[model samples]
Target: MLQIEDVLRDRGSRYAVSGGAVQGRAGADAFVAELKRVKKFAKATHNTWACVFSDLGPVKADDGEAGAGAVILKMLEREGLYDHIVVVTRWYGGVHLGGDRFAHVVTAVRAYFAALHSAQSR
Candidate 1:
């Protein structure tokens, strides 16, 4: 299992990104299980996540972050990533970022992929 953590701060809000590998086609239930394994993000304002399980297909959840989940899902689809799950936990700073929030989510996913590549190369 691979994992990386990153925090993206913008508009007074902080987005904590958790990128990890999903063993086989773990399904949505396994996605939730992986999330429970991490205690830090449990209390986040929004824990939007997306996963690509090639065997079972792709699944995503908004967790109250609106279209943020879709943003991550699109990235996963573009990369053609398989057996991977990326969770972005946003701690709302009481400020609305509007469309800009989508950009931040993209950044988080990109960072995760980069990290995943670097890890594999090593």
Candidate 2:
């Protein structure tokens, strides 16, 4: 059986939008666009994103990222690991992430996600 929590766990995978002084709308748009681009370039069949804002709905998800993508981002937010962050999950068709590769992918996106979040926060 697959626990929802297990599926949601960040596992250190993240992508963020940060820096510069941009309004909520612009910031959100930028992050969303970037996520879409990444997904397209990765040739991923699925791409999902979630954004949390104090004054807004707090949580929003894009079905494109698939259920797992949305769930994983939510899990990370719940853990208080990030704010104003967006994460994208790519399911490689042939290649597989057994060890370091998996970690690398997650870390790379996490860093970018953090950066995006940081940028908007400013």
Candidate 1, residues 21-120, lDDT tens digits: the string is 6665455557656666677667678888888887777788898889998899989999988777888778888899999889988988888888878888
TM-score of candidate 1 on Cα atoms, chains taken together? 0.85
TM-score per candidate, in order? Answer: 0.85, 0.43
Worst 10 residues of 2 by lDDT: 1-10
Question: lDDT (0-100) at residue 37 of candidate 2?
Answer: 62
Which one is best on TM-score?
1
Q: How many backbone clashes does candidate 2 have?
A: 19
